[model samples]
Target chain A: MDTDSPAGRARGPYAKSAERRRQIVDEAYRMFSTRGYQASSLREIAGAAGISLSNLQHHFASKEELLLAVLERRDETPAAETAAADTAENADENAAVPFDAAMVARAAANERIPGLIALYSVLSAEGVTDGHPGREFFLRRYDSLRAGYTAEFEEVRRQGRLRSGVDPAMAAASVVALWEGIQLQWLYAPDRIHAADALRAYLDLVIVSADDEGADA
Target chain B: MDTDSPAGRARGPYAKSAERRRQIVDEAYRMFSTRGYQASSLREIAGAAGISLSNLQHHFASKEELLLAVLERRDETPAAETAAADTAENADENAAVPFDAAMVARAAANERIPGLIALYSVLSAEGVTDGHPGREFFLRRYDSLRAGYTAEFEEVRRQGRLRSGVDPAMAAASVVALWEGIQLQWLYAPDRIHAADALRAYLDLVIVSADDEGADA
Candidate 1:
């Protein structure tokens, strides 16, 4: 019977606070793509969000905190993709997620959220130093990504869908590298480099068919 | 060819000046790997090189100039690599310089001057903006690198040393990506992740053979 009062109270200031935090995260993420962390000050970020320094501080408190939040959100993309892949390969969880070079390449070339790509390309590059705030986060990310891709390639190779001499581990690492490298170029010269076609071509090389030489001949 | 005339007069101060400039560049490049372009200050760089601020200024007026010098030096790596490949391939200019993944990988993994790799990884990331100083430099670099690698891959393909379905252009882009991505990781976790092994593994995947499947089957 008293649910209404409690619920209303919870919905009022708490809701606004959540919205403010979300807004700060959005502005910080936006800056990450363009101005980047080093170039943009926390004050500038607050100004971009049309919020007072105090308000922004109340939400993130520090630039590193805000960046971590952005990284958390950034994970949504690959997490979403992997989940979708898992769903598609539901009948057998262990089945290798077939490399869809052309589709992935085309999709990357014409992605909806280019900001994600920009944010990643810039931030990952900057995270290589000794004590970068995002160092641990990026290292873990590379490990997980390489491991995931490696496992997939290994499965595919085991099934003979990859060339015999093609080492699954190496292929996995290369694929990860291919993606990042493609994104790096795309961020700079979007018009010149076609990420999709480039990726698809690499996939064609690795993904074995029943008769690669025969078809070509 | 006077023994000690105008040429010797020019040599004294010029020699000292050249030595000073070289010292600054060396320190600047060393700092780039450890502290990065964004984090290291000009003053700190001068301090590291045991030179005064005024002396540093005499050589490189700004961070951009210093960075350009280091990058110029960095180009020597690939140039040396290609030259060695050329010598190995004889007078055949069109030889599909075999993608030496293992050698490249090992070289990258155990590089003596890791500063060059570190400097590149950091600067390339920072240059991802619209008009960052290094933007044009990096863009041109990617284009040149892609074109060069593409030609090499094309030669490799024509020689039937690449997988049948692999498009040379795509393979070239992938190779570029592979190097960059691997370098990115190597900068981050030099001990944990061996860049050379990973790259060699990838090379094993793409480089074709006479019996890719026939011998396997």
Candidate 2:
């Protein structure tokens, strides 16, 4: 069978089918992140991607499908840092650090990702249901995040950076909880709070070095 | 002109009408808690309460209305004590005790109001939206809870309960955040964790006496 059909032609030789798919997903992400999932229409996504609605449908069957794809794409992004712990060979190098200032800064910077934060806040609230599409996604997402933090804490312990007898899992869970809880507050009073700063302040408390504790106290 | 029209008679006595509304709300809460808001129909709640849907609607115009009423009712109940710094001369002496095994045992031994817990977990997750009726309610609820905790911490400080240099507002916020965070986990994996126990454990950490720090270490 000839590969140069109308569809094949639409996906140029330089731009493979996967590339086209990514382009569509990227546009969808931009739209959804800006206009919200409920307000951003598939037609607008198609228009933004310079493709027809039918072609968009050929790529993603529905808005839900596109949303799932956007989330999946985000999941695959290296920014999540799920494998950062396992890949780090010299975790002790940063063990003496008072806090992961770089990571906190990066997370803080993400506050400017337009509607991405609001989208996450909205979807998470909806994700509590058993059968919501985002349910398994968030569960796995949180689990992976928890595991990543736990691994970091383990490294901190190996280097004797953690406070004596600190339960890493509980501490990590508390950190995650603080992030989410603070997100809730930010959503309610966006004008009054800086979610990233609040999170950074909490992290500062937990990540205090042995030398810093006396100063912190 | 008649005070005892068929509709009036159907509502029963004044006291009975109030009781019936409470009963309907309680039943609706149970249904919504177990089945989730979208899945639990007004018909099912009515059936559970042994009343017709019309009767239920007469008391609450919609399922959302009923859920709100139930939530409002729950708000009137006493919450977990904030860590009070001071004990008033006539204040309950046991207020600062961390919720522990005894509390869980009491809760479990009681009428199995898993419905209320379930309702809270489900609604809290869903209530993150801007216009959701429960949104403002929860915002105020959390604010009140935080205020109460902060007050208790300040009181305890005055009474020499809390250690020096601890910021009571920050500590109170942490406690609230931890409680909310654990609740998310409990929702996803009820068999793996108990919200009450997790909260109690965290509270225990906060309330540890200065002399006991050595033992903890």
Clashes of each: 2, 8
Clashing pairs in 1: A105-A196, B105-B196
Model 1: fnat (fraction of native contacts): 0.68
Q: What is the interface RMSD of candidate 2, in Å?
A: 4.2
| lDDT (tens digit, per residue) of candidate 2 on A1-217 | 2266666665566466678789899898776544445546889999999999998898899888888887767546655332212112333446554335544654565555525555565455445654556678667766765676778777666665665545677666666666666656655556654556655655544455646442222
Clashing residue pairs in candidate 2 are: B84-B152, B84-B156, B85-B152, B85-B155, B85-B156, B85-B157, B86-B155, B86-B156
Best-fitting candidate, scored by lDDT: 1
lDDT, candidate 2, residue B124?
Answer: 59
Candidate 1: residue B102 Cα off by (Å): 9.4
Q: Write the per-residue lDDT of candidate 1 for residues A15-115, one digit (tens) a residue.
A: 77877888888898898777566666789899999989988998888889988998887434454332211221232343344446423633464455566
lDDT of each: 0.66, 0.59
Per-residue accuracy of model 2 over B140-180 as CA lDDT, tens digit each: 76676567667766765655556444556766666666556
True contacts kept of 2: 0.26
- Model 2 RMSD in Å is 7.2
